[model samples]
Target: MKSSGSSFYDRIYRLVGMIPPGRVATYGQIARLAGRCSPRNVGYAMSSVPPDSPVPWHRVINSRGRISVRSDGEPCDAQRQMLRSEGIEFGPGGTVDLSVFGWRGPAGEVSNDEQW
Candidate 1:
């Protein structure tokens, strides 16, 4: 039987996949939308994503609009670079201004022609 954890992660992945390239969603936002999970669960799901997955993992950040440090202690430069390539700018304080770049939700899904 399929584990419920897998199902929850799938829901989280689908939601994260919908986050466009330049915009970002907070872990809290994803959890709230995904339901039956917490921000920490969202973080866990992100960490478990395979390198080959299509989910845009870099587009999820903390509520403070900053990248959460990996448990493995790796630098977040890669995430920063990816976001930069997608036109996301960071302030001098090293946090994206949530007001400007925060994704509203999947309700405003990008058009089919728009490359995520």
Candidate 2:
């Protein structure tokens, strides 16, 4: 059988796959959807995703509505460009407008009033 870590990573991938173009989900949101993983675990799993993986890993952002930078310097900036290409607009602070673009996955819609 696969290790539990593998299982958790697979679940995170599946959840991340559901995020459509122009929309995003946060580290905490993906963690809750993946059952046993925490937000930090989600980040770890994401970091391990291969560059060529079919998963749209770029759609995952922080709860503050900003992209999580890679281990490299701030110049590893493709995530923001990808989101913008899909018409997801960022505001004055370089934060995506999560209320307008957050993808809540299949369970239901996340209310626009959510503090995030």
Which one wins on TM-score?
Answer: 1
lDDT of 1 by residue, 41-89 (tens): 9999999999887899899999999988898776489998999899999
TM-score of 2: 0.82
lDDT of 1 at 91: 92
Which residue ranges in model 2 land beyond 4 Å of their true spot?
1-5, 108-116
> Please, what are the lDDT tens digits per residue for candidate 2 over residues 1-68?
43536667888987887777878999998999888657999999999998776799889999999888
- The C-alpha TM-scores of every prediction are 0.85, 0.82
Model 1 alpha-carbon miss at residue 24, Å: 0.4
On lDDT, the leading prediction is 1
**Window of ten residues with lowest summed lDDT in model 1:** 107-116
